[model samples]
Target: MDVRTGLFYLFSVVLLFAAFRVITARNPVYAALYLVLTFFRASGIWLLLRAEFPAITLVLVYVGAVMVLFLFVVMMLDIDVDALRAGFWKHFPIAASVGALIALEMAAVLMGGFRASEEPRALPGVAAAAQAGVQFSNTKELGKLLYSEYLYPLEIAAVLLLVAIIAAIALTLRHRKDSKQFDPAQAVRVRASDRLQVIKVAPTRPAAPPAAPDTPAAETK
Candidate 1:
């Protein structure tokens, strides 16, 4: 095929591989790195689609910010892979069902997009601007669409993100029996004696006087 199509396929293949590795990799750090790769490939695909804003945003937002944070957390945390996977077989059926449902939904959406027969129709203003040969900004148009048509969905997404942030904080801040939590106020007010102790014992015995070394006897001459 042409160069664009070739690049698209290349990015798609790498993206799929990286996405798969994100889920299957045993090391969490490797998984996060793979996810970063997935985002980069996705951004490249978006660039090929001529959606520059989305491509840049994907790289800057997800790759630069989110993936860095994910990598930091994954690397810092002592993740118990065995304990985490202990219930995997027990939960496999439900997880499989949910995954299948999501796959079906994605298939449906892709099928509908492919089946669309009509050419993409731009907004009336955008069409007029195009006819007049006025420079158009897709980013501006996207902003308008987000603030107008998709406002509710955008607000809902923000709320959901906020809820997720709160939930994560709640989970992290939860008290654990095994954790050695200390009160800062109590620690600050403590006396040195509470934290340290010094004891004196009588000397085992008085210091012995130094013994004088005998001079070597002069060689019998």
Candidate 2:
């Protein structure tokens, strides 16, 4: 096989192994790390397909940002693995069925895409740009589609993500009576006079001097 084909098979094999490990690994941190390896392998495959935008985005967004956060969370958490796995056997049958259904659907979609009669066709804009000898960017086309046709759905998704973030923060937030915290509104409304106070009192009278020790002459006398 040629270099590209060999690399594709290598990446695909690693990707599948990493994905399997992600699901089967006993340690959450290891699972997260495996997931990161899976993402990197997927990005490599995307690069091989000449989809630079998606490959870079997959690495930068998922691996760099999301997976790092996930790994940190997994490592930091004090999880009871036994408690978590308590229902594994009970749920295994359903989970296996769902997994099988998903696998079948994906296989059908992929096989349909690989039909010999189906040929790749360029987009209208891309074809026009090609005829005019102008360079057309898939990223620019993606941006146009996101902003125009899918704008509302994109906005809805953004709002949903914002809600999810707020929910996560709220859920993990702890309130401690022992911890000192000031209300921002109260702090903003505070005045100098409220913060500072002066007390006035009558001056204390000086204490009388202590009597001197009896002189030596008095002792002699």
Candidate 3:
């Protein structure tokens, strides 16, 4: 096989293995790590397919940002493996059936003799430039298309993601009575006198002993 085809198969194999491990691994952290590995291999496969923009985006956005966040979250969570596995047998039949169906569907799709109707026609300028072995700027082309044609959808998606991130932070953060939290604005405006108060009080002397006179008068009478 050609080098490209060989590399494709290699990356595909690793991707599949990593994806399998993501589900089957007992440790949640390990599962998250395996998922990150799957993303990395998938990105590599995309790179091989000449989809450099998507490949780099996949690595930067998913592998770098999302997966790292997932890893941190998974690591922070106190997952009890035994508790999680308690209902494994109970759910096994349904889960197994679903898994089997998915596997069968994938197998059918891959094995089915589905051929492309036609080789993809490159853009008017793209084909000529490609033939000259000149590197085409996929990122630039994608940016143009996205901003020009899909700007509204892209902006909406960005706003949605921003809302989701804020929601996630709000949900994860809690007000704890024991934990000390300070508002930055309040802190910045605070005066030294407001923060510290010193009071001077005159010290009181102890009451003098007065009981000795009563016994002396009784003895004289």
Name the best candidate (by TM-score). 3
**Candidate with maximal lDDT:** 2
Q: lDDT for each of the candidates? A: 0.90, 0.92, 0.88
Residue range 1-221, candidate 1, lDDT tens digits: 99999999999999999999988898889999999999999999998876789999999999999999988898889999989879878999999999999999999887866666857767786788899999877778889999999999999999999999999999987889998777779988999889899889977988899998766674433
C-alpha lDDT of candidate 2 relative to the true structure: 0.92
TM-score of each: 0.62, 0.64, 0.67
Error of 2 at 58 (Å): 1.7
Model 2, residue 73: displacement in angstroms?
Answer: 1.2
lDDT string for model 3 (19-95, tens) is 99988999998898898899889999988878888898888999899988988887888878999999999999999
Pairs of residues at least 3 apart in sequence or in different chains that clash in candidate 1? none
Error of 2 at 207 (Å): 34
Query: In model 3, where do residues sit more than 4 Å from their true spots?
Result: 107-134, 156-180, 186-221
Q: What RMSD value applies to candidate 2?
A: 8.8
How well does candidate 3 match the true structure in TM-score terms?
0.67
Model 2: weakest 10-residue lDDT segment is 171-180
